[model samples]
Target: MPRFAANLSMLYNEHGFLDRFAAAARDGFKAVEFLFPYAFAPAELAARLQDNGLRQVLFNAPPGDWDGGERGIACIPGREAEFRDGFLRALEYAQALDCPRIHVMAGLAPVGRRREELKATYMENLGWAARQAAKAGRSVLLEPINTRDMPGFFLNFQEEAHRIVEDIGAKNLLVQMDLYHCQIMEGDLAARIRKYLPTGRVGHFQIAGVPGRFEPDVGEVNYAYLFGVIDEAAAQCGWDGWIGCEYKPRRGAVPYGTGEGLGWLRSPVLPGV
Candidate 1:
């Protein structure tokens, strides 16, 4: 069975950020992930994890000026220094928290700048980041976000991300295959999963209902079937990675809504659960 990680950033908004860790553990989740952890001290976050018996599976590197709408600075020219500093900070947290992977968001593509220039910057930064992460025994992940949710995002397709991973030639560099984004940008989810999972380049997976970012069971996508596909494919390749429950609850922020939305996790769709 595939391991599932609660995405605390979205799943338990009804609780205080720190309190969400206990909420997730109460709901039988063994692992958790979030967008950013820079707001809290690493020691405090680690304590929460230790207390709840939860593992910190993933989190993002600092996205430049998230309030200013700069998703990431790694792709922008002249921000290499800032990007490196942010990644190092992220690595420090990763070490303190004992997390293994960090996702680096590819910033939105600017209209006036050449695509080639942005891509060159992205590759160079990733290459450097990968080398640094490798020394720390952690992996760096690149995810392809759909344009609808994040318009003009530099990375959008699975093939493109895998290609970049291959070109960068970093063993510690891997793709974060988010099924929601993949379904939005490309329809053949099973084919993509089969093709990519076996290559050992996929480090993580995420899911949500399509047409709406709600629980997986609410969408048109057949997550049960896809889950089975993930199991079969992963077993063949020995790819054991957590699938992050990265979706909004259908019940909004009401108490226990996130836990209630977890009925899908108890169903027969996920064998051996």
Candidate 2:
């Protein structure tokens, strides 16, 4: 079975941060990922993970103005110094949490900016970030968020993410293929996985039902079949990684809830497995 990671950031908004971590542990998840850990001291977060026996599978480099719609800045020109400082801050947190991977969010390029210039800046920052991560024995990932969900984002498609990875040519840099974005940008999910798996660019994955961006069964993505495809690809590529549950709960967390929706977690390994 593919290892599973809980994205605590999405799991329990009603609960306090530490309480959310406790819930994830209680649910039997051994690994977890978060969007940003800058809110708390790195040592405090690390202590919580250690107490709960959870491995920090993934977390993102700090994105400036996280609440003001500044998704990230690695690709923004003239902000290279700010981007580097944010990345280093994340590296320190990663070390404290013993995280093996840190994702570098590719923020939206400025309006009226030339694509060539944005692409060049993206590569330059990624190369520098990758080197820093490598020094810490960690891998840096570049994620492609869908423009439909996040308009004006610099990198929105797998093809562009692939090209960027190729251009950087850093062994430590890779792409994070979020299934939610993939379903919106590209329909042939399995084929895309196969094409990118060989390049070793798929460093992480996030799953959600398309259309609704809710739990797997709430939309038309057919995750049962999708998981099967992922399993096959992992077997073929020898990928031993965690699949993050990064989606919103249908009716919020109901400790006493009952339905097929919640039961999907127990759904057998996708058909072909």
Candidate 3:
């Protein structure tokens, strides 16, 4: 079994964001990850993790204007400065929380732009972020979001993402493989996991149901089997990082609370380590 992390941004929605830290720890989660930490003070989030005894595994670098439909700013060509500034801000938070990874969203590529230029800008931004993270003793992750979810999402295919990771050529920069999006954009989950295992390039991992983005147990992806695959991948890669439970809880008559849908993840990663 893999070590699991509660994605406070997704799981534990029954409580406020700050309170989710405690809720996760109460439910036997040893670690936590989230989408953004910009809304609260880094010191406050750090305090919550300390109080709850949870490790901050991962979070995304700032995406530009999330409310205005911009998924990220890194690949947006002219937003290089903004992207760097956002990365620095996120790094500050990561440092405070003792987080090890930051997901850099590639942003939605506008239809009329030059694809080459877009890729260049994204690579430049990620290279810079990777260098900074390396200096901070952290890693940078780039996730390939499915086009179905965001329409114009810049990074969509596994091959493309792999190519970008190689092209960037930074040891601290790797793929944040989200099983839900990978199943949507590409279907060879096991093969891909094994292929990347040799390089140990997968920096972080997330899971959700394929068609509905809900609990993994309810998905087209056989999470039970896939969980085994994940373990193999991690073993081969020598990875002991968090497997983030990034999904919606299966709704019941009452709202989903902490641990309501965790029967699928019964295996303990260790005997309390």
| Evaluation by TM-score, superior candidate among 1 and 2 | 1
Q: What lDDT, from 0 to 1, does candidate 1 have?
A: 0.94
- For candidate 1, write residues 1-273 as lDDT tens digits: 689999999998888899999999998999999999999999999999999999999999999999999898879998999999999999999999999999999898878999999999999999999999999999999999999999989999999999999999999999999999999999899899999999999999999999798999987888988899999998899998999999999875765568778888877465431
- Give the poorly placed runs of model 1, Cα more than 4 Å off: 270-273
Model 1: which ten-residue window has the lowest total lDDT?
A: 264-273
TM-score for each model? 0.98, 0.95, 0.95
Model 3: how far is 175 from its true place, Å? 0.4
In candidate 3, which residue ranges exceed 4 Å CA deviation?
Answer: 252-255, 267-273
- Best-performing candidate as measured by TM-score: 1
CA lDDT of each prediction against the hidden true structure: 0.94, 0.83, 0.86
Better of 2 and 3 by lDDT: 3
